[model samples]
Target: MNSLEHLQEKVNYDKIFDCVQCGYCLPACPTYETMERETHSPRGRINLVKMVAEGKASVEDLRDPIEKCLGCMACTTVCPTNVQYGQILEGAKEVIEEHDVKSMAQKKVEAFLFESFFPSSNWMGTLGNATWLYQKSGIQKFVQTTYLTALAPMRLGRFERVLPDLPSPFERAFRKRRVLPDYKLRTTVAFFTGCVMDGIFFKTNQHTVELLRLAGAEVLLPKEQTCCGALHSHSGKGLSAKELAMTNIEAFDLEDVDYIVNNAGGCGAKMTEYPHLFEQGTEWHERAKEFAAKVRDISEVLVELDGLTFTTPVPRTVTYQPSCHMTNVQRVSEPPRMLLNNIPGLKVKELNRPDFCCGSAGIYNLVNYDESMEILDLKMIDVIERKPNAIITTNPGCLLQMKLGVERHGLEGEMEAMHLVDLLMEAEPAAK
Candidate 1:
């Protein structure tokens, strides 16, 4: 049986028809906001999906909306009737794949990794350990010398900056089950330690757990969880994404956990789409929805709880890049700002185009480097104008992309980027 047959989700009739064609989602959509094409906007894309389902639209007609969505799901949260557009959009993507097709090579490369790696943390850990070993053994230098990995979509320059070397901050792997010390009440939380955090940003992961523990929650880093498949879905490989969804469904076994805490904004946003990926009558499909219901970004977690108690002073004029996933995709505009304000010396300076997409729309910098860099270049100028000491965002993709933008513009650490969770964890504001 095919995957969609397993998802078995009924088309949400009431919410789907609620669109008034006002085109409000056009400005709200990053890609549509960037391209300004009707086909790319939310309403236009909704119409296109409707036409496709009703047999009035061709597979070729789908190319734009699918490409345009960024898989951001920015439209649904803002829609009055609460149309879960992400589910519909994902269904459309599966349909598109069923009819039209790409090259075997392209399909193979995508399927191999997404199917193989995304659902298993052990396998992912191996991949990370290999990369870490490569760098440690100077094999990365050899690859750079030979211009090998650079030939891939995400080049050495891009990968080098984003891939932080693990500094051996904490040599302890989080127990499959653990308890927190700061228990006002024992709240159970599942964690999505994404690929970067699991391997590269180990400190950030530790910080995330520390902050969560501080906030009174027992955190679980399930060995079964893998990549959130956010990048694959965003990159137009929904079939692979479905496999990942299935993998995580079985792996996580997240029952009894109150929420899946994701420190990274992009991963958190993607985790919320678990229901949309599977369409039919399988456990994985149900599990996907079950898991998604519990997902929360770190900022959202902090905001929902008591505000930050900054232990030390931040003392920096901070420029805020509302990560596309956190702000537009997930429609979480306020939580991050709220977290920042509680810090002792932090100044949350807003960027000129706060709602606009940063070039790093997750592997966007790799596949669509030109446009992505172009977007970053403009964002960099805004940062330069602000002359802030730090730029805080909630996604690894944004932090890396913006950090690169700072570097390309020759600013480097003079202007730094960090995850909002990491910043707040730093500000644990002990009772003085």
Candidate 2:
């Protein structure tokens, strides 16, 4: 069978037909706005899928547009017909992955990333440890000062400047597992410390646990939890994503917890859609539904508690960059804003296009370096207009991307990027 036949079998024809071609998603699309090409727009991509299904286009023709998409799902939010764009996009991605011929180097990298690195906690921990050593042993400084970083890829070298200070392996090993509320415990939740979130942004994960405790919840860290498989799914490794999802479902056996809480918006959104990774009526499908139903973003849980007391006055202006997945997929928007408003002395400034993507759709910045930077630069225009003291984000990817933006725009000391949970922790009473 040809690639078109595979697509015909894999693609959801019904979902593609849902697009009314009204172009409602054009303005909301970062690639559409940046590239100024219809092929990159949500409606255009949907049409391409429709064409591929109808044999008017080949699978190769659909590869570029699908790969270029951030998978942010912003288009779904504005669609008048409520097109299941994400499902269609994922299905097309899976078909492409199966049919497309990749170079040996690309295949090896994908194998390592999808089959080996991401799914292994040991590797992620090693990465954190290696990063810690690089920072602490003066190697990082020497490399930066000597311009050795220039020898690396352009995107990687630029990203090195904004990499978070990862916690040492020793620190991570001894991190707290159960955090009890100082006052009454309103609920119990199992915290899902994501792979990259825990490996790179370990401090933020720690802060999330503390913030949850402060919000009157008993927090339990499930050690068996693996990577959220978001990167895998977005990159078209659906089978790998499903394996990771099943591992997480078994790890987070959520029979007793009130919710399975997560700090990263991308991870949380993927976890909530676990059911989509499985077929209906299957045992894993029912299990995924149960797992997904319990998934909740940290902001959602915090807002519902309404028990946190802020003592320190932030006395700073900050603009929020909503995570596209958190907003469009998880359907969480107001809760994050509500929490920000509750902070004492903090002013929340709204960006011109507040819901726009920061071009950090998972690994987009690394893979499509030039395109991602273009989108980031476009997003920076709104950031420059706000000129807030800090840019706040819910997802780790958005936080890093905004940090790179702050650096690129020469606003380093004047501006900073922070995760929402960290900001909340900073506002908590000093006595802690």
Candidate 3:
């Protein structure tokens, strides 16, 4: 079958009609703002999908626009007709991946990342250990001093400079699986420690668990939970994404916990939409709905429990760069701000475009480095205007991207980038 046939067969061609070519999504689209092209905007892309389905354009015509999309879903929020753009986007991605021929090396890399690296806890743990060794064994320093990093790809070198210090192998090995509240337990929650969250930003994950415990909850770190499959779903590996979703559903079980809380906005948004990955009326689809309903962002849970009260003051001015998925997909905008506002002396300055994508839609920055940087530069313009001490965000991708933004704009020493949980931990009293 041809690409058009695959798209017709697998893609949600019916939903393409939902987009009415209304111009509301253009202003909200980061790519449209940056690229100044109709082909890059949400309505423009929707039209392209429609054209492909009707045999007016080949699937190849849709490839660049689809691939270049941050998949931030900002347009969906502003749409008057409530267009399900995400489903359409993911459908196009799957059809493209199905038909496009890839070189051997590219195929191998995709196989490794989608099938092996992301889904395995053991592999993620090993990655953490490897990174720790790179940072701690003087190798990083040698590479930096010897200018070896200069020889590497520009994006890799920039990312390397902002890479967070990983917890030592010993620390990761001895990490706690569960923590009980020092005070009376108000509820029970199973924390979704994400693959990247566990491997790279392990300290942030640690802080999340500690904060949840302090908030009067019993936190369970399920052993069987794997990656949330956001990356797989975004990349068009639908089968792999479904497998990971099922693994996570079985891992959390949802029988004992009042909520399945996650700190990463991208992971939370994806987990909450698990029901979309399966066929309606199927057993897995129903099971996915049950699991998705239990998923909650940590900030939402904290607000629900009235758990934020900082005795100690954090005397710093900060601006929030919200995660796109958290804000747009998860429909969580105010909780992080509410948490930030509760800090004693921390001043919150709003960005001009608070809902703008930081251009770190998962691995978009890595794959589309130049385009990502363009979007980040646009985001940093509003951030620079605030002149805050730190740029705070929820997801790890945004955290790193914001850090890179701070570094790229030569604001490194003047401003820092931090995860919201880490900042909140700073405001907690020392004796707690």
| lDDT (Cα atoms) of all candidates against the true structure | 0.69, 0.86, 0.88
Model 2 C-alpha RMSD vs. true structure (Å) is: 2.1
Candidate 2 structure quality by residue, lDDT tens digits, 263-331: 899999999999999999999999999899999999899888876878988988999999999998999
Writing each residue's lDDT as its tens digit, candidate 1 over 133-170 gives: 77788887887788776576435455674466654312
- lDDT computed for candidate 1: 0.69
RMSD in Å for all candidates? 4.5, 2.1, 2.1
Query: What lDDT would candidate 2 get against the real structure?
Result: 0.86
lDDT string for model 3 (290-395, tens) is: 9999999999998887754678899999999999899888899999999898899999999999989999898778767889999999899999999999999999
**For model 2, what is the error of residue 205's alpha carbon versus the real structure, in angstroms, after optimal superposition?**
0.6
Q: Best by lDDT, which number?
A: 3
Q: Each model's TM-score?
A: 0.80, 0.95, 0.95
**What is the TM-score of candidate 1?**
0.80
